[model samples]
Target: MGWNPFRRAPLLHVANDVGSGPVVVFIHGIASSSITWTNVIPLLAPGHRCITIDLLGFGGSPAPLDAQYTLPEHVAALARTIRSLRLREPFVLVGHSMGGLIAPRYAARHPGGCGGSCS
Candidate 1:
């Protein structure tokens, strides 16, 4: 298939964004989706803004035919999503398994983008 100039770029899916307070971004592990934080979010939502994402090619997010789904690709998609949120403060990043791998890389590439992290 040929690239179409008019085709809109794909975007990652934000599975859930609950609560309102300090931000807490959650990234799921491989073969998993934002659902991973279902139980946890409810616990933290009262005190923190819980933002859960479905990584590229997972959950509600797109999986472009041209995408390689590499670590960089995943991080890039994540970066775009984070930027779109237009956050006022650095978010606390939390991940599980593969998401654990991604969280640090994201922090390393975009210093100050994350105020803290857990995996």
Candidate 2:
């Protein structure tokens, strides 16, 4: 079989999904994975839906050779993954380090897709 350009990699990997309420998505920094939020998620999970994801090329997410791992690419992958969740309402976004960089960009690009963010 040929290298199928149309066969794209799946969206970023979701590491954790807990609780039930307003949504909160956590993004880890460069050289990190969703596991970084281990202790934090519990505090928020009681009153909100807590979700953590591995950015593209990190943790459980695919690292395609063709990927440049740019800000746009990361935001694009994150948007796709969030869209896949079919969230009923806008959610809060939180990021650490490089993830802190990506979170705001994603919020800017997607608008109401993210109600608020912390970096």
Tell me the number of clashing residue pairs for each predicted model. Answer: 0, 0
Model 2 ranges off by over 4 Å: 1-9, 114-119
Which pairs clash in model 1? none
Error of 2 at 29 (Å): 0.1
Worst 10-residue lDDT window for candidate 1 reads 1-10
TM-score of 1: 0.86
lDDT tens digits, residues 31-96, model 1?
989999999999999999999999989999998987767777777778778877777787899989
Instruction: Pick the lDDT winner.
Output: 2
**In lDDT terms, how accurate is model 2?**
0.85
**To one decimal, what is the Cα RMSD in angstroms of model 1 from the true structure?**
5.1
Instruction: Residues 22-51, candidate 2: write the lDDT tens digits.
Output: 899999999999999999998999999999
